[model samples]
Target chain A: EAGVVQSPRYKIIEKKQPVAFWCNPISGHNTLYWYRQNLGQGPELLIRYENEEAVDDSQLPKDRFSAERLKGVDSTLKIQPAELGDSAVYLCASSQETGWGRGELFFGEGSRLTVL
Target chain B: GESVGLHLPTLSVQEGDNSIINCAYSNSASDYFIWYKQESGKGPQFIIDIRSNMDKRQGQRVTVLLNKTVKHLSLQIAATQPGDSAVYFCAETKSSNTGKLIFGQGTTLQVKP
Candidate 1:
């Protein structure tokens, strides 16, 4: 069927403005992840959710970044008062792994944010 | 469109030739390793994966060779085509919190037609 879907394919905002990105994962996928990819760098994990519980979020910047995957299907990542350094592609991915298994991750086109 | 591997290492190959891209992972205890292909302005697509217990895995037209002794991984593309040109990434994953998937910087594959 359809793959993961993300909203606002591209966003541009001035520094210190608030920005938000949304994601809808594949159907029947139980795990979701949020990652940030900087220019010329690989995507880094920001938060991971299994169902509705956040299993990993150590990489997320709590001071300015926050994420929630309510209902275990769609997720939203928010950055308040965005900084110049916060400009990056926010990617959302989903997997079908259970328990301690690591399955293939299906990713979306990503929300590209540019902060000036 | 924005390119993904601006400062990353590159591998240039001719059409219909064999191509090999290598990566050195960080964790030796990682449960498994995976390969992803990402094109310009697109998300990464899964290519193949190999578990720690396995040294090799083959896909449609690709092969993944894992050398755990040196914590190295390689992806071999047979009869490489221009469509195969993209950024390749290798990631290591663990089951625990400390084992989040660590993605490599990615290698740009330039296939000359």
Candidate 2:
């Protein structure tokens, strides 16, 4: 069984440009999450999806960041007019279910974005 | 807002010696805790996990000790090896059924061979 997969392992863009990252979670997983990790910092939750519904997005910057999981299996995170501070690794994770605290998430290698 | 934090930013230990990493959490309601290992240019990998009810849990060569009273957590690596060198993180969650994990700053472990 393959783990979570993400596209464009690395991305580089100039400030004010648009950038997008894609993620494909593990099979049979019903919960997916998007997180941003900066240098010397842990990954912080940006958004969370239960199936196709986004249940948690309080931490997401709606002004420039948007995410969607149309079919519930794959997800895409987009940042329009990316800023220099937006440079970081975007990680995707998935779990079997949303059952309390028992769900163990499987994460992907993450997509590193560099905005100049 | 509750947060998780590591006591040290880095630790250096001999390959054959024992190593310990410490973390402190602000949320007393957190019932679940986990430890993760991350290497350069890769994702975090699960190492071990322990519940609030248990004080200690041991894996192959790693042990996780949880002190609910002080809201502290620690990971102990026995007979540490060079391969164990990586950034270790401790995460906590208050939602028993949700998968939301609040991770600590992380501790860089450098095993000297």
Candidate 3:
């Protein structure tokens, strides 16, 4: 089986430019997550979707960051007018809904964004 | 907000020696914990996991020890090899069923050949 797949492994843009990242989860996975990892830091949750419904997005910056998982299969994370602080790695992960919150997550290689 | 933290930023060990990485979590309600290994330019790979009810769980050459009493966790690698060089992270999830994981600042493991 193939792992989670992400597009445009690396992205470079100027500050205030718009950028988008795409993710395709593994087959049969009902839960998808988007996380941002700064240098020397662990990946932080930005948003979570459970079968097309966003269950958690408290950590997402709504003013500039937006995400959607249409059809409950693929997801897209967008950053409008990206800021210099947005230069980091964007990771997408997925897990099967086991009801016990013990599901193991599988992640993609991630999209590294560099904002000048 | 409560967060997970690592005791050390880096660790160096001989190829044939053992390596241990430590992590401290502040959330006492966390019920599940996982350890991940990440190489350069790659996503984190699951190494091992342990539940709050268990104190220790062992894999092929990796062991995860959880100390709920102290809110601490540790990963031990036996007969470490150069291929084991990577950043190790410990993550915790609460019982809320959200499946949101809080990860620690990772520890870089460097094994000398």
lDDT at A90, model 1: 93
lDDT of 2 by residue, A1-116 (tens): 99999989999999999999999999999899999999988889999999999999999999999999998899999999899999999999998876564646788999999999
Q: Is the docking of candidate 2 incorrect, acceptable, medium or high quality?
A: medium
**Candidate 3 wrongly placed segments (more than 4 Å):** B1-6, B95-98
User: Each prediction's DockQ?
Assistant: 0.50, 0.62, 0.57
RMSD of 3: 3.3
lDDT of 3 at B79: 93
* Best model per lDDT: 3
Q: Summarize candidate 3's per-residue lDDT along B62-107 as a digit string, tens digits.
A: 9999999889999999999999999999999864573688999999
lDDT of 3 by residue, A7-115 (tens): 8899999999999999999999999999999999999999999999999999999999999999999999999989999999999999987357664778999999999
Where does candidate 2 stray beyond 4 Å?
B1-6
Better of 1 and 2 by TM-score: 2
Q: Please tell me what DockQ candidate 2 reaches.
A: 0.62
TM-score of 2: 0.95
Q: Which 10 successive residues of model 3 chain B have the least lDDT summed?
A: B1-10
Q: How many residue pairs clash in each candidate?
A: 0, 6, 0
> What tens-digit string does per-residue lDDT give for candidate 1 at A43-111?
999999989999889999999999998888999999998999999999999988844665478999999
The Cα error of candidate 3 at residue B46, in Å, is 1.1
**Scored by CA lDDT, what does every candidate get?**
0.87, 0.89, 0.90
